[model samples]
Target: GAGVSQSPSNKVTEKGKDVELRCDPISGHTALYWYRQSLGQGLEFLIYFQGNSAPDKSGLPSDRFSAERTGGSVSTLTIQRTQQEDSAVYLCASSLVAAYTDTQYFGPGTRLTVL
Candidate 1:
């Protein structure tokens, strides 16, 4: 892909339903990241993956949230039993370099709404 690609640009679900968001990263990129942005909460890192290294999943809010990256490429984020507080935009990014300071290219996020 030229840049990251995210599916279902907008999703509206009743509270308690589960939702799955997908991300397709740029070609040859080795690092991928997931983030969430809310009304006032700026971008919050959700997870980080670099090649075969252990992923950083410390940012996930609860057991209801999970993600996985396969073959160092595509990734999926699943939220189970979504709540009203979970309504926000889920963003995905990728970078060629795997460092704290590396610049990442972001995808048009999947907007999740729980009502």
Candidate 2:
């Protein structure tokens, strides 16, 4: 399989709306991550998944943000009641294994806008 891929590379939504971002990790990768990058800022970790166990979701900004990985392959990040502050590029990455030193392959990211 190819590197991580995200759909709807760009999105625009009005305030209070909901949006879902998708991520497809590389085949056989056991660790997947989701991040958010604001304009001119570094990536901020949002959530992480390893195998099929519970996900590490401590980085989510608020209750409105959540994510899930199904079948240890594809993942989805959902933002409910979008706000202008939620506008940013959502990035996804995958690693061959779960290790602090593992190299992560990243997706291009989905740009979301809240109007």
Candidate 3:
């Protein structure tokens, strides 16, 4: 992809439902990250993936939120049994590499709303 791309710029679902968000990162990038931003809140790091190392899923709010990066390119974020409090923007970012100087490019993000 030319840049990070995220699908379903907006999503509205009832509480207790599940939703899947997709992200397509720039080609050849070796590092990908997912973050969440609740209304009036700052960015919250959700996960990080680089090469074959173990993914850093430490930031996931709970087991209800999960993600996977495949082939080092595309990624998906799934939120199960969503709650009204889950409403927020899910952002995806990618860097050419995970070095200290690497700049992460961000996607437009998916605005998820659990009604």
Give TM-scores for every candidate, taking all chains together and pairing residue i with residue i.
0.93, 0.95, 0.94
Alpha-carbon local distance difference test for all models: 0.91, 0.92, 0.90
lDDT by residue (17-110, candidate 3, tens digit) is 9999999988888898999999999999998889534357789999999888777788889999999989999999999888799999999999
Question: Which portions of model 2 show Cα errors greater than 4 Å?
Answer: none
**Model 2, span 29-112: residue lDDT tens:** 999999999999999998888976545778999999988888989999999999999999999999988798999999999999
Q: By summed lDDT, which 10 consecutive residues of candidate 1 come out lowest?
A: 48-57
Tell me the tens digit of each residue's lDDT in model 1 across 1-115: 3889999899999999999999999999899899999988899999888873535789999999999888888888999999999999999999997787878999999999999
Model 1 compared with the native: what TM-score?
0.93
Total clashing residue pairs per candidate?
0, 0, 0
Ranking the candidates on lDDT from highest down gives 2, 1, 3
Question: Using TM-score as the measure, what is the rank order of every candidate, best first?
Answer: 2, 3, 1
lDDT of 3: 0.90
TM for candidate 3 is 0.94
Candidate 2: lDDT over CA atoms?
0.92
Alpha-carbon shift of residue 75 in model 3 (angstroms): 0.2
